[model samples]
Target: MNTAWIYLILAGLCEIGWAFGLKYSEGFSKLWPSVITVVVMILSFVLLAQAMKTLPLGTAYASWTGIGAVGTAILGIVLLGEPRDAVRLICIGLIIAGVLGLKFLAKE
Candidate 1:
């Protein structure tokens, strides 16, 4: 695996962190959560930029956002008491499949 991919994956995870942080921040009213949210968001974008240096922009952005969306959705269902319906779950699965397809088709 390429170092850029590692960075991209980490960035995606960081995006999940920030997304949760934003939810917990209550519109940035809280101090620590808001701070962490900003920090992690910056880190995520920086890592994504680093990844874009090596990978195609379209491929990298798609993978990055796909990972973040899937992870955040799952976490919302598990950690945040979000609803888990069949259609929603299936859509998430399709997003995962799309991410995998993009990865398989991408040139590295």
Candidate 2:
């Protein structure tokens, strides 16, 4: 509900965007995708910094990366036709659990 949390969530989503953009950019060979990726990457860092002003450093960083990893992995499976095996899904679930645990345990 806090603004810091919102910023953190948005930063996570931007992290996902940049990750996809990096893939589409093909090592920056593609102009537009590379530009977008750079912009989104900056935005993600800015938002993460904003959240860090309120959140504990460890909690904010871990949660941000966890969100990006989980989101990117799921999207990769759906959009990019990546693997959908049980072990992978279970691993993703574990990451989600860890992120949620960090969130709940965080004092702020």
Candidate 3:
């Protein structure tokens, strides 16, 4: 795998962490989670920018956000007790497909 792809994946993971941090932060009322959220958000953006140095902007961004969205949605359902509807699950599958398509077809 390309270094940029690794960075992009790391960026996506960090994005997930940061998003969860936001939820855990409770509207920034809690200090620790809020601070962690800021740190993770910065790391995610930094990795994303690094990935953009090599990857196509549109493809990289779409993949990054796709990963974040899918991961977050799963976490929401599993960890946060969000609803698990059929339509939402199917939409998530489509997103996964699109992300996989971009990953396989995209050229470095």
Candidate 4:
């Protein structure tokens, strides 16, 4: 329930949104989506910086990137009809486990 943790979670959510926006941008052909994606991505980084004010930079960055990758991949599979093979699922699970392990380990 730490404020830094909340900020990190918000940053992760923003990353997911930014990723979706980027996909919708279609090489920036869609002006509004592309602009929104850029804005959201910047906001996400800003939030990450805020979180890093208290959290260790390496830990915060690793968690952020790990969660972002997992979330975006899951979103792609669910929303975009991307493949969900066993190997892909296992990889995603490993990413989640690694992120969780990092979080727990950092607490002590």
Candidate 5:
């Protein structure tokens, strides 16, 4: 809703991008994917730092990681043929709940 939150969300998205880039990069062996991964990784950290300027450190960090973990897991399932068992889905749902709680219930 605010600029800091926006930055955090964008950072989370960048986190996801970099995660995929890491896979595509093949352990940094690929040129373009590795470069893109590094760039996105830097962007993610910068945006996260910007968010931390206003957000409480715990909330910001947890929410940022929560978004990244959830996004990456879902994408892994969809794109990389990862498992999609009920337990895994349930765990992901719990993570989503925790992230939403941090966003809406956090004082700042």
Candidate 6:
């Protein structure tokens, strides 16, 4: 697998952590978790910038946001009991397709 892909995956995981952290932060009163969450989000963005060094900026950014949005939405549904309606599912599918399409275009 490409290093860029690995970085992107790491970025995605960081997004999940950061998204959860924002909820758990409780106005940033919980020191440790809040700090960790901020740090992880910063690191994720840094990794994203690094990945962009090789990948096209538009492609990298779009994929990063797409994955993060989809991941965070799924997390909200599973962990926070957010609704998982058909429209939301369709939107997620479209996001995934957009990410894949960008990747494929980059390969050409």
Query: Where in model 6 is the C-alpha error above 4 Å?
Result: none
lDDT of 1 at 37: 100
lDDT of 3 at 31: 100
lDDT of 6 by residue, 47-81 (tens): 88778878878788888888889999998999889
Q: After superposition, how far is residue 19 of candidate 2 from its true place, in Å?
A: 0.2
What are the RMSD figures for all models against the true structure?
Answer: 0.9, 0.7, 0.9, 1.2, 0.7, 1.4
Candidate 1, residues 27-55: lDDT per residue as tens digits? 99999999999999999999999999988
- Higher lDDT: candidate 1 or 4? 1
lDDT of each: 0.93, 0.96, 0.95, 0.90, 0.96, 0.86
Native-vs-model 3 lDDT?
Answer: 0.95
Report the poorest 10 consecutive residues by lDDT, candidate 1: 99-108
lDDT of 4 by residue, 36-101 (tens): 999999999999999899888887898898889999999999988999999999999998998788
Error of 2 at 7 (Å): 0.6
Segments in model 3 whose C-alpha atoms lie over 4 Å from true places = none
- Candidate 5 local lDDT, 23-94, one digit each (tens): 999999999999999999999999999999999999999999999999999999999999999999999999
Stretches of candidate 2 above 4 Å error? none
Name the 10 consecutive residues with the lowest summed lDDT in model 4. 99-108
TM-score winner between candidates 4 and 5: 5
**What is the TM-score of each predicted model, taking all chains together?**
0.95, 0.97, 0.95, 0.94, 0.97, 0.91
Better of 2 and 6 by lDDT: 2
Best candidate, lDDT-wise? 5
